[model samples]
Target: MTKEENEKRLAYLKSIVARLPEKPGSYQFYDDEHTIIYVGKAKSLKSRVSSYFHTEVDRFKTKVLVSKIHDISYTVVNTEEDALLLENSLIKKYNPRYNVLLKDGKTYPSICITNEPFPRIFKTRTINKKWGTYYGPYSHAASMYAVLDLINKLYKPRTCRQPMTKEGVKAGKYQTCLEYHIKNCLGPCVARQSFEDYQKNIAQAREILKGNTRQILRDMRAEMEQLAEELRFEEAEEVKRKYLLIDSFVSKSEVVSHTIDNVDVFSITNDEKVAYVNYIHVSNGSINQSFTFEYKKRLNETEQELLQLGIIEMRERFNSHSKEIVVPFEPDMELENVVFTVPQRGDKKTLLDLSLMNGKQYKFDRLKQAEKLNPEQKQVRLMKELQEKLGLPKLPYQIECFDNSNISGTDAVAACVVFKSMKPSKKDYKKYNIKTVVGPDDYASMKEVVHRRYSRLLEEEQPLPDLIIADGGKGQMGVIREVIQDELNLDIPIAGLAKNDRHRTNELLYGFPPMSVQLKTDSELFHVLTQIQDEVHRFAITFHREKRSKRALESELDSIKGIGPKTRDGLLNALKSVKKISEANLDTLTDLIGAAKAQIVYDYFHPENTTGES
Candidate 1:
């Protein structure tokens, strides 16, 4: 905008801000298009809105946001807590561009115990508040199914759609269906099970859904014992089966502590673009519910802010009245009755760790899925990661790694392996036979190869590799830098791959003085670095072996006077070995080569006798 226009816009914004009240509220920022671009909650609406237009608003994104604002709107609230809730609601409603986006808008399935004459329990994605009590919006369907399966086994609730009332059962308006015959239901509609008994089972199922299984287990055990005392063996055996089922279910749950009931545990993991939060709700010593979700960052929100928003959103969604929340760190917001915990050790710490693991796993799985769709995304990410780690000027699009191979100075060879876009470029691979450097002088060999590789690229007017890697440790890294930077006067970044005592790729060394670059052993960056080292090593070793083999062949057969390359090749092909050629008689050699070549060969190996004289 022009200077006068900018002044006018700022003045207009300041005038609107001046009229704002200093009460807790949610505010929305509108852009030139008159659309809500950002939504935020603050304790003082006037102060928060005014702060955005201040000269010291240094955050680049916030500054850009201020520039785009053509109008402002807000809703005053009685307290900060109300402001937080209102902010969340407005963000969900309008989905402003500058608001943290809830990425996983998935409506997960929940176990609903229908509020019918005979409550039917099943999994549902849609919630109807009149439908008895909902156990969860289970993030994992298998968990919800397990709960329903246990409920089915224990209660044998009616699956029929017909409303079962006591009057209908007495009037014979409903009949027992196949579910009754299959022993899946107790036929509450047909009056086979009393209303009171069915209601009692429903109550027990509710307790189990709430993860209050101890009371239900004790009741089932007592009922089973009573049946046994009455000599009702079949009924007692059935109750025993249910009692054991509930017991097994309880044993499988992650039991924290009986004292840590109704507490919420949360942990967060984030990158530049998104943040993930994992929530675990504990009830009666068991993890009753767990979920991991992501937030698409807008305006570069801090992890604390994202986490605070997540906490409020989750609590409201789950209808949780959890007074105590276990967090990795205290979030930037507060709830009236809630106490935040950052535990050092104990059950809460374990829960916090578990939540962190889940959040990280969720982020990893999401990245994996995205990479599977576009495989190049992973390569680009790894390249950027390496670039960032090394503080390189650019992405390591083309990496060249050098390795030397020899058997105690014999057949010395060096190989250069090139990786373009983090993949091996086999055609670009170069092999160098040791010319200037004799013996197992690895440093000299690396220096020679590095000088040769880049000098040729410069002479040919071709692009130099973004990075050059040495297959040996610190000594080799110094040799490369001296050759590439000092002698050749090129500015390529050089790194070294160091092997452990076991000759396994162990660490990466880079920069002057060569500090070890810390890389996780299992990470892709480590894998790719190791791949380059191994490839170069393999290429160098194979070249050395081939050179040695040719020399060995020349020593045996090339020394023969009449045996040219073709003659020697023919003999080797026919006889399969030098030993076999030596063992062959003149007649056999004549058939393979000519009689004259055969005589020379026979005479060379069998100098004791003249071949034709016999």
Candidate 2:
């Protein structure tokens, strides 16, 4: 393709990529003549496929791969596993010229039952037809081994490779190994434990491998009870140990129960050219699997695409059957009966966020692996973190915070403070006098002030801020939302900063009805929020105090026993203020208000000179 053609092609690719669904699926990259060059899977098809043109990818191979692209296609799947299997199958079928081979990628071990007469149960990377049963293609060998170890501990399955036969045992040709000496095995080689009994144990072990450990627990409990009733203390004790082992393992694995029995959570985080995706699997409210991996965006794929692909890849790689997938976005894929959710503020949101954090951490670590620290790195890092943390679509280059203050139903006022790039924007700070509400009605005062502020901005056609923060709880936040959204018809994001009884910022509230968002108090975002809240509160209080002071200054002279309003006005008009009046000479005051009242006013204004506290 020519340079101009490539530019046009990139733009066209971007448009098509933008329409990719966020669901678990696989995608294909094609050259100019529509020859398939690469095949990939994604949890979000749109996010993944669209990312190719995100930036000028640094890797040479990626640059070539993206440059060769002309058209793209995708296959939507119900789960991540389906995407992975599809990606594998499609890659093999077409032999995409530019596709990168995942080396020994599917070599992870699985628990296998050998086809021998006395089947040996163990973890193996090889899948042979001679293996009686294969339990998993576990994402990690440790996971498969953990299950195998648990099975051996509970059921005492023989670990020996010695082939057992009735004739060999009858002829005394087989002897018990060290496993029997250590009581880890039941000596099936010597026939101390019959094949029927050992086979029964193996059957139960198979159930655990199949994720039906619950049935085994119930059966073990009943056996324990029966043994205890029969006065078989040793057998009952053994059953009790196995039951507790399974129960503890199960209980420790639970994550959340708000959804259903099975769920897969996918989250994505990315840098300029690379993306990291994290996957979490929850079964029976327990986290059964979690992983984070990297993806190189050949065409500048977005975080959305990377995360979607990660979900598909992780699910497919782990062979997960979860139908309900939790994500931070709607991948826009139509998978039958599979639900994708974007939770706001609940347990599900928490889990999704946890996965997001993992992705972010993984990306951070990867960046650090090659990171060269510069002066602006921290600032850039903070801005990006804030963008992710607040779920803001854009970086918070401009933030506006508001507060309302009243002094004993007097001097009703509000203040708006500006923060630009996490620093105070003093020149943009604004103060307002309460105009619409009577008494100490903070809600009305806030509504009036916000309406006036934004109304002027709208009339002037000024840019709205990236974020608006209200220094109050839901009630006050509702008023701001009403003014900013309902009245102005603007689509600005707003959050509430609430204080505890001690007047300290303790929670950040967001969403329609406003739910408290969890945050670590020591985090930089929390600190920034606290700073914004404090600045607005301080500004409002300062303005309120100044107004009250002015009123008090004007009224001090009027409080004199002999001074009336007319006299006080005359003195104030001449002297400008009580402070000025205090500095005025006796002759000046007497000239402004008559001698007797002027003396009273002068005495009140200069109480210190009159022997009383001023």
Show model 2 residue runs off by greater than 4 Å: 1-36, 40-88, 92-149, 163-173, 206-212, 229-233, 364-614
Question: Which consecutive 10 residues in model 2 have the weakest lDDT in total?
Answer: 98-107
| The best candidate in terms of lDDT | 1
Worst 10 residues of 1 by lDDT: 103-112
Relative to the true structure, candidate 2 reaches a TM of 0.48
Model 2 error, position 570 (Å): 86
User: Tens digits of per-residue lDDT for model 1 on 1-614?
Assistant: 79999889889989999999989999999998899999999989998888988887788988888889999999999988899999999999999988888975347888888878788888888777876777788877788888888889888998888877788889999988999999999989888899999999999898898788987888888999999999999999988998999999999888888878899999999899999989999988899889987899878899888998998888887788989999998777778988999999998999999999989998999899999999999999999999988989999999998888888988888898999999999999999988998678888887887787888889999989999888878898888889887898889898888889998878888899998988888988999899888888798889988898878987899999978999998888887788999999899999999899899999999998964544
Residue by residue across 490-608, what tens digits does model 2's lDDT show? 88888888888998888888888898887877886789788888888899998988899878866676566866777767766776777787788788877876788767766766677
What is the TM-score of candidate 1?
0.90
Give one clash count per candidate, in the order shown: 0, 30
Models, CA RMSD each: 3.3, 14.7
TM-score of each: 0.90, 0.48
Question: What is the alpha-carbon lDDT of model 1 when measured against the actual structure?
Answer: 0.88
